[model samples]
Target chain A: MPMTIDSSEVLKRIEDAPLLSSSASRLLQITADPEHSLGEVADIVKTDAALTARVLRVVNSAAFGLISTISSIDRAISYLGERLVVGIAIDICASQLFDKPLTGYEAQRGDLWRHDLRVAIASREIARLAPQDMAVDLAFTGGILHDIGKSILSEFLTGTAQSVLETIEKGEAQDYLEAERAMLGIDHAMVGYELARKWQLPEPLQQVIRFHHKPSEADEEHRSLVYAVHLGDIIAMMGGGGTGSDTLQYHMDSAYTDYLDISVEQLTMTLLHVEEEFSKMEASLLDGKDGGT
Target chain B: MSNLILGVGDFGASNSPGDIVKTFALGSCVAVILLDPGTRSVGMVHVALPDSSINRDKAKERPGYFADTGIPMLLKQMSSMGCNVRKLTVKLAGGAQIMDPNNTFNIGKRNILAVKKLLWQHGMGPVAEDIGANYSRTVSVSTNTGEVVLSSPGRPPWKI
Candidate 1:
């Protein structure tokens, strides 16, 4: 018999999950605010010496192909922007989670991070094309953290990939998410939502983590942003950057057209752009690669 | 033994025996494998889209990114190595719907069709294939024997 987990047990695990660092959390908070300035983002980075170094390291990394090194935090923040800086901080703080081998999904270590980075690039591209005024950076951040729940839920799902796939193939479930719920009693999205709430993340971020797979269900104000992420996630998987067996297993919400105005041609161009951007970002952000002085 | 791994929009051709051309994590993307028995030469192209008309300039720079461009490029590369097109064996893998039951983007389906249409235009077609489904695939083709194998998570490697 498959292991049956209680919602309370999952909630307890979320409560025990490590908290995001103040710098990372604050960056997430500030960057989501449209009125926030680069100076304010710089100020937050100044408070955390370690994050400052990482910011500089990434900015100077070969990904940017900078002719000269960026020595100041303010310059680094301005050059790379708050979203990437926050991404660096969050990456450092959550390295373990992002890099964990998802045995459940049969994904190798670093697979989750690579998939997220591709989604971030694709999401940011989609946001830039939104008909409404949208915060493209927030979409990038949301894309990075959208599947954080998978890391936690992966263990419980260990060795169940074949069975889950069978359930879907047998018509016992609508999709992977439904299969997850049917077998485990809850899905990764719900677990991620619980973790987001526990971490006191911004409401929009929480909504993205929870409703990215179902954008129409998200609050109206953030529906476009969620749709951007929804398409971004699919594009990432399509480009062959999926985490594991579940890659592209989620439904592509067609309602995204109601929120974003991207045409099929634009989407094809977006996929090409994502391929170009992702190569650079992956080299710079992935661990053990030389970022240069 | 040597391995030449192809990322999305990558192409490779090898005539040396014991060489393997492989690509991993093919979601909606499709890979075309070619083998010439006469020369023991093998080539593969991982195509991400159907039409090169989407971006002519990108097509010029990375011909392996679209089926219209990538197939011809792979054929040219094989010919350059003294392999005859008519005598070459071809196989296809990937182009899965993944989870898009509605085929909203329809990229995977389109990719498969586009590749087939392009091959038909070339007076050739795939001799073996394992295309379409909801899972990702990792594929490899050996230069030594032109053996094509496909593997996915939690599944055994099987030949096409």
Candidate 2:
């Protein structure tokens, strides 16, 4: 066993990590309460020039195919719905964080970003087919941020990435998380959970980051949400977004399917649409910045 | 050399010696790479599923995404690029399965079997490969050297 760093050190390192845009952060805060009016939130989004520019660019982007211009943040919100607009803002912010390569995990430029986006897309799809009560935007956010820990821990693991992957490849470790723990005394899931907490995201979303790889371990109330993100992770891998050294080391937990009364066939069909959904999302919103100018 | 990438459900052929062709992370999917030294041409496809029979609608549009239609379609593309079936050397990679007992799909094995059957019909086989392990691979073929390199992080680079 290699000498491992303690959790405290990892916490201290991430203490100053980059977080969501202040406008996006306040937007999440105001929207978290059930009673807030969307116009109030849109008014806040309208104030941040950078945030407003992103929203207007996405709203008018070819993805929406709007016949008439949206004209304002409130009009854009009315057209796309409050959840997705916030999602767009959060997505733009998250995309910046995910753009870099995590070499220890062997992610090339744009690999992690693509994978996380696909996962977020898959989670939105899975949410529809799973339990009806699953929070829509939360599911998407959880999916995108599920692997944030890998990005955080990657810089620390560069020297040992080889040995860690070798152990997993050679069967000394069961999977990437196990390999990470044995070598570093911490794993991506826990680190990701901590990062989510530090970002002041809702608790349920934090649970998703922590137990996505092992949904059974999540608390009862959050089990369904965890299931959606978990299946989303697997489907993203199936869709060819599966990159990095760790690859598909994650195992599918059938118990979640059993618990949720969803069949593998049902799950598989939903999964088949993952690539299509990703393409649609990419073509519509993310890459459509080119369409405006 | 510049790189030409074939994303999922994609296929491409090139006779240009200045371009390298590549596809990333072939899990259950298979990447069939063909190189013809005589013409200095290379053709590649990233096959995402085993058989398109289940989804005939998709097969009509994306025949290169399935084994039955994809491998043949890839061969036809290579043929258009002056690659002779008898002279073309093939390289195969990807088909890693989930390292879990509950992995029921076994799409990786199905992909490999399907590719082998198609190649058998053509009287050819993979000249070199590094396949069927539980790791995602990024594979590239340089038109300059006709060398295919498969890498998975810490795993030593496998060259064909």
Candidate 3:
């Protein structure tokens, strides 16, 4: 008999996928702390030569435009901040997954990375403007890993794009997430949550990965952070940084207004900041670098 | 022959007959295309926002990012290239309402309105447009034939 595929099958595949490097994993854990120090971040980079070089290059890149070259890992981590340091570490560790072609979504290679970068920038920007205090770096980190589920889900979704779209169009499904659940017996969020568990990502980051599309579903303690990433995801898509067929298919939970109180003018400003920061980071990190595995 | 690709907050113009000007993946952003039949001159601006009052510095740095600034700059560039305003054919593409259902995030609608208002202020309007959708778009204009084409994901490129 042909095997019946389900979320278990997707979970099994996640176990087979390459694990995050020990250094990258350590960076994620260290940076998740609101009081994480420059030394803690520097210690992780000091051990990895490739990551150290990339961090130095990015700090000196045209994006920062420092007059003097800083060769020390401590200065580099301090200058770039733990958020971006973590981003670079993740980019190096998962370049293959980040830069892969989302064949099911009909998206090009590097599309996912670009989208994630935009989301990271936008998330950080929104978090800075929120009325309540929150960890902006955590939001940025969440944005980077929010759509990781897509990398694995794409293979299972091959040749299903038209049906998914038609299902959305006909209102048989609420959005792409629902469509994925209806067809595949599992959505990207659940698949991503399972991966987060496997990777041992922080609870807040895991919540962001699962509830980004619907922030209300996240735990109350992390709701605001999740909301920031939710709006950040929307802003990234609005700014034309979406990944393929399901680009704008997800519903924007207006409940975010309850968590993040900001006017339309402020929202527009966030878009500008996202574009500016996205261009700089893309040029520094991924522009000339070989993004392939 | 050259294809001038305009990124967000950017615009370009070409008078060469073999040139094509285009912008990619316009989600909420709008692209204004100007073509002059007399000179075969074409210009394209990828407008990202409605007004420049929000950030004058960004507007100064990249006038092609806002309808209030970008439209005027494109018109000025086309005229400077010796293309006649009266002879210009205005066509607009993009300005899609991607995820906003409650109109809370209505940048696409606002952008469409702003671009139309700006063009009206210039005493012209889009002769043809493909605007206000839930999908993203990539728009291209041919300086050779004054042809405006739009392509979306999973869809064929079509002329407007």
Candidate 4:
């Protein structure tokens, strides 16, 4: 049996929910203009104490391979650069957005968090291989939040939605999207795109949420970034880093190669690279959060 | 039944006996399987991306994840297991496109192409294979007979 989410109710809840702002506004402002001074970005970051602490902790983490310790957000921003600092802040912000439990997905409170982090790491690595025209940070952000819609649906799948969850756990036959489409009439990607648009996320990220599961549908301008996230998600899923509820729907779009100017040879190399990076990033991101939220 | 088992996130074991040398649910990644009929040995790798040169730091942490780095490592491991490079027969699988058509995510295609290129460079070519499909696959290789099989949803098991 397929799953379903009441689109109207989901949309209503999203609308009613308070717009929780993290450091995303400041980070987006910084990313919009590269020439924007670090002082300006730092000033915005200083307003949020929690964001400031997360930023400093990440900058000091071994993932960046910084030789010296970063004592403050400003120092870390200087060391990591405007683009990456902004990217990390945005990621930290979205982490809160996805902190809720996903019922249909069988994801624990933090399962989505780990999944998003893996996709971000993989997307950044894949972006390095694509043409320089692509924005690597944009790719990373898109990858991290590609499944935001799942969180929205999870909340509404209250009573009868339990069956959908059961079907997923059994690994019966249907992919999550199909189950969702059958049960809820709308898939997570669509729901995610709606939420993204409502939240005023950047176009590239919204495009990713809509097309990460279907990259061939993306426009020429955003195709490569969409493709990177698609591949990154696949790499994470294949490596056993997935949330384990939706393993049946591994779909691949062939046109992605032609769009990205990459051959089959390049794809193989890229997946290898994604796997390597996921391992490193996974260790770094989960360093002390063992107790599980 | 002494079937060779390739552990998760790992590659290559030759001259071992087992029911299968298997890699599971390869989506955008590629699995390169090498079989030696003479030695009845088999090896397989579940690689996530095509290259490691993009980020050397990540590559160093997980060598088995990239095609450029992992394929060579697989070959070296096979050789160390008493399998002759010349007698080794190769087959490839995985690299499914799991996203939409318009999104331009072709990492699976890239991994498939990368594996083929690396094989060509190393004077090794795939004798038979199934790659670049739109669905995920679980690949299994029998060490006893060097038979490679692919299983997908609603599809019959087929030999490569």
Candidate 5:
């Protein structure tokens, strides 16, 4: 029987997916606190043997090309810094959770990984460029995980790829998100929102996940952050990075640039920088593992 | 025949049959492939923007990034590779709107138009193409067969 890919089913997938270790979850929770300390984050990571290994592995990997060998979680946190530790500890769970070919979205093996990584890098750069306007660190996490729901929703959209895309692109629904809501009764963004909540991610991250595609709908308080991730996702897709069926399905709102006080030229240059970074990361982190989709 | 990768703002021409040049992840960008059957040479360039005027510095620095500058450069290179400039079999793919925020700007459409205009100026035409859709395409050209193949996610690859 074909599975109906409504919100409940996606939520169920998130529920069924491997739960993050309690210790990792706790460490992630403190990241939401403005006053969270590096030691405090380290202490939480140390509770789980597996979490400690995960943090140390990424820090010590050739991706970082570290000079010193770190033996302890505390040492790892001190060396890598707090937000990065938090980002990576959560990534330990994310890599396991979202690592797969999401056929519904037409993503081949490794496509989503590359796409999300590009978005993460793009959003992080945007956040850095606008440090006074938004919380850039959180933007990095939000940028990568913004498409988390696609990991679940992709399963449901598989058989419906052509029709769904046609309806979204040609139909008068304005965009894919609308077509998704109108036709599939759900969209990837909303599903991602539920997954973020289910994983106990920070509320800001959850909101960005839900609103990454629609920055205009996001609250004004962190709209800049939302816009950053939004632009990051768009920029990533602009290069066709890790794309599937619904590529042209998104409609760019010019208002987003006005909201962030950025010009298209700036955005274009930012995309170039991020793409350069992406090539370096792909060369080192994902070299020869690619079967391009 | 080694495959040379064509990154954005890059163009290369090869007469070696061992060379199979290709580029991947084309969204709003376009990949232009020019093949000369007589010389057994192929030239491919991944163009990211439509106009060189987007940035004069960028246009001067990387001619392969824009269609206006890149297309002429690519044609010039393909001709210099022992091919009759007027007799090349030009093929194009990419120009997808996969990542546009709104339809307010269509770089893909602009790229296709610019390339076509340049070809017209040269009194040449593309023999085949697989252009304009919302999906990312990985386009490749084989100097061995003078064939171009376009692949998108979940869909079967088709010859252009």
Candidate 6:
């Protein structure tokens, strides 16, 4: 027999937890006002010495391919622009969330981190194709945070998580949502949505968290963004450096292309581009040997 | 033996006597199908990215992953096998926006645009296309008769 857990209660518990407080605060401030200069943003980042160092290290790394070295937060922000800086802030903030293992996902501590970063990179590259303003920093943020609920759910279902992992490893045919629903009575997408709302993430991001796995069910207005993340997630899974235990494959919905006015050639081109981008980012992220600095 | 099927994550080709080459499940990623009606030689390359310039080093490791690199490579391979570019009738499928309403990351749309631009630049426009729907499609091209068909979920298969 399955017990019904109140999502609201779970959400409240997540909200009360003082996790990533400083990083979340910085993101809120940056998103609240994009005009804030590098100095202002840097001030917020500098408050967390460790985060500031990581940000600086990432910018100076070969990943960005800068001709000259970027030594300080202010310089890094100025060069990368406020939007990218905010993106980096969000990335650093969410980095800690991946420290714990996801039992339901068979993901080692760093696996989720790598997967999220790949999705973020792919999503950002994809975003480059859209109009600049509509790019929505939240896309990258959402891409990075989309799987957070998997971690949460995995933590909650410690015992059953192993079974799910075993099933996936055996190449069993099952939808991840169905399996999750069967095991926990609710899917990770819904749990992620609840957590997003509890955290007061932007409305668009909340929608992204809820519908990334099933964009067709999302509200018509934001369906395209949800579809983008969905595509990104699938591409990430297909690229397959490190996917967690979710083996359910969702077919790509054609209506999404019709709605967005994209064509088959375009989707192929984008997937290729995203795959390329993911490969590069994957190498960079895992290039611990080079130290990347 | 006559019908070469391209599975998900797989590519297919046929030459000599010429055979029908078919691929299924195209979404966001574009499937490039090339056929020489005269020789009946057919080849299809399904690529998932636009350009490989962003990471030339990695592209070398996986040339089939990007359109910019993969398309040229496919063309080169076909041409080397006696498939003339002029006789090559091209059909494209896939590139659907599988994302959210806001389209914060409209890679599918961008990819389609890039393919069009590339095709125009190279003087090879797509002859037939059924692309950019919220649905997934399975595309098949018959080298024997040059028939292109697209099938969607719960819907009857249609010719393009």
Best by DockQ: 1
Better of 1 and 4 by DockQ: 1
> Tens digits of per-residue lDDT for model 3 on B1-160?
9999999989889998789898999999999998898898989999999999999998999999999999889888988999898778998888877555456689998999999999998789988999987778898888888899888665557999
Model 2 lDDT per residue over B72-122, tens place: 888888887777868999889988766434454466777788888888988
Clash tally for model 5: 8
In the range A1-293, model 4's lDDT, one tens digit per residue, is 53344668777766754453656765664554536677987887789876676667766676667778777878877865555555556555555556776655555677676677677767766777775566776677677778777777765554434355456547763456766776667777888888877777767777899989778888777888898888778767754456435542556666656645654445445545555566555654454223211
Residue lDDT tens for model 5, A1-293: 13344566556777776676676578667766667777788778777666676667655666656688667877877866665565556556667645778887776777777787788888877777773656666777787678877877776677766666556546656676776676557888988887777777877888899998878888877788888888788778877775587765676655765656555566567767887777765553432123111
Tens digits of per-residue lDDT, candidate 1, A1-293, equal 26677666666677767789999999999998999888889998999988887777877787688898789998888887788888898887888889899999999998999999999999999999998899999999999999998888888888898888777778888778998887777888888988888888898889999998899999998999999998999899888888887887777887777888876688778988999988887877652134455
Over B1-160, each residue of candidate 6 has an lDDT whose tens digit, in order, gives 4777764334556773546677655655677777787777777876655666656765687665567766677778788888787668878887765344545335556557766776666689888887664445667776666677776432457987
Q: In model 5, where do residues sit more than 4 Å from their true spots?
A: A1-7, A35-84, A129-132, A283-293, B1-10, B13-20, B49-81, B98-133, B154-160
**Docking band of candidate 6:** incorrect
Error of 1 at A217 (Å): 1.5
lDDT, candidate 3, equals 0.86
Model 4's DockQ?
A: 0.16
Per-residue lDDT of model 3, residues A1-293, tens digit only: 11225767777788876789999999898888877787888888999988988888888776667788888989888777888889988888788889889988889999999999899999988899889899999999999999999999888887777677777888998899988887677888888888899999989999999999989999999999999999999899888889888878888888777888778888888888888888888887853264311
Candidates in order, interface RMSD in Å: 2.3, 2.7, 1.9, 6.6, 3.4, 10.0
lDDT score of residue A154 within candidate 5: 73
Per-residue lDDT of B1-67 in model 1, one digit per residue for the tens? 7999999999989998888889998888999998898999989999999999988998999999999
* Cα lDDT of model 5 by residue, B1-160, tens digit: 6988988889998998678888987887888888888888989889887777757887888999888898889878877767787788888888876444654346577778888887788887778887876778888888889788887664668887
Q: TM-scores of the models, in the given order? A: 0.96, 0.86, 0.95, 0.63, 0.81, 0.58
lDDT of 1 at A290: 45
Candidate 2: residue A84 Cα off by (Å): 4.2
List DockQ for all candidates.
0.65, 0.45, 0.59, 0.16, 0.46, 0.05
- Give the TM-score ranking, best first: 1, 3, 2, 5, 4, 6
Select the stronger candidate by lDDT from 2 and 5.
2
Model 3 steric clash pairs? none
Q: All candidates' lDDT scores?
A: 0.86, 0.76, 0.86, 0.68, 0.74, 0.62
What is the TM-score (0 to 1) of candidate 6? 0.58
TM-score of chain B of each: 0.95, 0.93, 0.96, 0.89, 0.92, 0.84
Q: Lowest lDDT 10-mer window, candidate 1 chain B?
A: B97-106
Model 6 chain B: worst 10 consecutive residues (lDDT sum): B97-106
